[model samples]
Target: MLEEEYQPRRQLPVHLRPPVQPEPVFEFTIRDATLADMPYVREIYNHYVANTVVTFDEDAMTLKEWRTKFSWVSKLNMPFLVAVSPTSTVLGFAYVSPWKQKAAYRRTVEDSIYLGPAATGKGLGKALMKELLARSKAAGIKEVLAVIVDKGAEGSIRLHESFGFVEVGRLGKVGFKFNRWLGTVLLQKHLK
Candidate 1:
């Protein structure tokens, strides 16, 4: 009689084994931001400023500048949201601000989304952006603009497109960063 072929069972190394206890899914809460959230907000923003082309600013913002920004947004009664975990750790933030300083631009606001390094790819940015847009609509914002860097930001471009923002313009070589010139893509979603 032919003996059945024996198959060896593969064993995973201890470190490669799946965790016996699964980590609990992180819980997130989205809410209107207050003065107390300024530090966390600034930290998240500065993370992008220091590490990415999400903004063209070469220098990180000081706490005083962040505070001034918060004050300005508050005075405008614009929408600002913070995503927090159950323990109140800020994961990300989104807000709407005047697109331009001119009075004619009052109804047009630029939207900004910033996430902590660890908070990306978990849908937190999308959630925050949705809430921000809802609040902007309720506040009578006519146009929502997204000014995005054109270099390797396909994810951001896709996200805005998914939210009904259409590419309205592209400015070439408008930004200098990372030892090279970069372009800017402007997307707009009409709210009114």
Candidate 2:
């Protein structure tokens, strides 16, 4: 094409542009999880399993499996909590499990938190973490460990760091998911 025949790029007028939708601002309360909450919890967790690398789980958890896990954690005297909306709708969940089964590791625990797809990025994660840490401390737990996938969990790392969790170590290519190698960042915090 000749320079004289060149045309300038056309820009869509403001009226023709798509509207930007804002994320919803949700209100919820965090409380101890019940048997009924396990199904919702499973859905939230399975969302991550099927869609993201935040968790290395390749298979979705069933209600029976989640129930067993709930029972086990309850038996250990650990807190399993959920965030719920005004109508008792489960929006997210957080819990602590024994860091290691050995007797010597009784005072240490690992935290796991997950939010429903519609309930993420609205500060509910922090709220759940705050309550989880408090309950962990009250349960005589001294150490909290977080094992976060390195590639897609930067938000989780920052969240843990903001709560005074320090990076203890990292293992490279320790997890394989989505047909690719993934690493982990290990962070630890001690309850005072």
Candidate 3:
């Protein structure tokens, strides 16, 4: 390995890389989300909205928007939770929303998990997801779905699949953002 022949390694995009560590032993508490967590939650999600294709939303969400969502999820009694650090900072958040408004879809929900930029790649995602699934099942959710971005979100797809979520369908090029077309990968898990 001569220095002259050395080439810098090309790294995969951040969102595409899998966590290198095994089952994260990090310290974080998963608890119910409160109105006080809205600002942090908004900041975490809006980062993806503004800079990444992980989320189809191009505009950064307002705190008001997050508050409304929090209210709605609370009303549904669906497990809306957050990961808090020992210092009480919100490391991340996860929640489920009704998959559809129809009566027949009442037992089905879509799960969403997002972590702060500084909190990523540390296994917070896996912890959040494990708790979210347990809570979802206890909440009487028969079906859980993950609608993930087709590109720039491979890690999320892999995380869900690791938890028994399977690729049920895909919608190609349904969203246009950042001057490019994007698609969605739909993953589903059925609870016993």
**Candidate maximizing lDDT:** 2
Give stretches of model 2 more than 4 Å off: 1-25
Q: lDDT tens digits, residues 30-127, model 1?
A: 99888889899888888777888879988988888877988899899899889999999988888999999999999899999888888888888788
Q: 68-162, model 2: which lDDT tens digit per residue? A: 99999999999999999999999999999999989999999999999898888899999999999999999999999999999999999999999
Across 1-192, the per-residue lDDT of candidate 3 in tens digits comes to 999999999999999999787864668899999999999999999988998998888788999999999999999889999999988999999999999999999999999999998888998999999999999999999999999989899999999999999999999999999999999999999988
lDDT of each: 0.89, 0.95, 0.93
The model with the greatest TM-score is: 1
Candidate 3 local distance difference test against the native? 0.93
RMSD to native for every prediction? 5.2, 3.8, 8.1
